[model samples]
Target: MTEDTSWVGPAMQQRVPWVKAVGITFGDVTARRVVAHLPDDPQLHNHVGGPHAAMIFGLGETASGAVGLAAFGSVMDRATPLVVSSEIAYHRLARGPLTAVAELTRPAEEVLAELAGGQRPEFTVTVGISDTDARETTRMVVRWTLRPNR
Candidate 1:
């Protein structure tokens, strides 16, 4: 199914208010990939003056949800998508603006087929966070499940 990801940012803002409250921005959202950004603000800085780890984690999680929505929007009538778990690791001290790129670990079509077979399909999205200089600063993996509606 083709999803118009242009609605991702706005929809996220409405459904997950914290994302917008934290000043996260979105770019190029597709079924398999979604990109999000977090501005470097003093209020969001950690002890060392870098973006706080929690904010960076939020950026990655939001990006994962964006891609998941893009991939599964058409099937929402029958299933409710939820995050099962997530793991994030900071690779370097993040400075300046940060960007997160999330991609599905498996093809959307395949996962959809599993749902069609009356199975609750679980998939993982891998997100890579980078600094303005294009240096990798963090990595995250979010596992999601599309629970069939009762």
Candidate 2:
């Protein structure tokens, strides 16, 4: 199972018990576009009672990674990739429901084609985390070495 589609996405959640336990959802998983869902849980609270930094970090990181997965059309058949590094900044306090969007950087289509045909592509997945109120809480940049499946 992979996180590129609904069936596979939810199915693979079992592999990451911690993430699933925290109520993170892989809503849209496709190349060039990535989106994720997060519930406003109390466990994600900070000293001030807003979402904790780690929670925001997790949401932003996952969203960025998902974008790379989506850039490949389907992550169902690819090898599990690891995050080499992540650098993010919080613009404001995160509140309410949050949505993360990752738009592919570089030549997305060409890179995906190469990856599907047996190539390892290193790229940056830029993502933004926002709330249902249409407010952005953070901007994240995730860099990874993507090894896709044929």
Candidate 3:
């Protein structure tokens, strides 16, 4: 199914403006992936004068969460998506504008099947943070759990 992600950024900023403080904005969303951008700004600088790690983590999670909703919204109407856990590895200091991209690792059918059986299911999305030069700066695996809204 096709979904319109054009409103994602504005809607997200309205829901969580703190994310906007760190310069997070939705870049693109497609059936295969969701991408977010974090501009290179001094406001996001660390004590050492580099991008803060926490902000980077937030950017990744935001992107992944957007992907989750777009990819599974139909089945997730009565379910709530929660971030169960995440693992991130920073390869180098972020020195430029950053882009976080999240893509599904398993087929959508598999995840929906579990939900159809009235079982809470978990899905993982791998978000890669890349610099303006397209160099990988960090990698994060965010595990999300979908539970009945009750």
Which candidate has the highest TM-score of all? 1
Q: Cα RMSDs of all predictions?
A: 1.3, 4.0, 1.7
Model 2: how far is 8 from its true place, Å?
4.9
- Across 15-50, the per-residue lDDT of candidate 2 in tens digits comes to 667668778887767666667878888777888877
**Candidate with best lDDT:** 1
Per-residue lDDT of model 1, residues 10-129, tens digit only: 888888889879988899999999999999899999999999899999999999999999989899899999999999999899999999999999999999999999899999999999
Give the alpha carbon lDDT tens digit for every residue of 1-150 in model 3.
566766666766777778767768787786469889988888887887777898888889988888887777676567888899999999988877899999978877787888888899899999999987899999999998889877
- State in Å the error of residue 120, model 1: 0.6
TM-score for all predictions?
0.95, 0.77, 0.90
Candidate 2 residue spans exceeding 4 A from truth = 1-4, 73-80, 112-120, 147-150
Query: How many clashes show up per model?
Result: 0, 4, 0
**Could you give the candidate ranking by lDDT, starting with the highest?**
1, 3, 2
Model 1: per-residue Cα lDDT at residue 134: 91
What does the lDDT read for residue 98 in candidate 1? 96
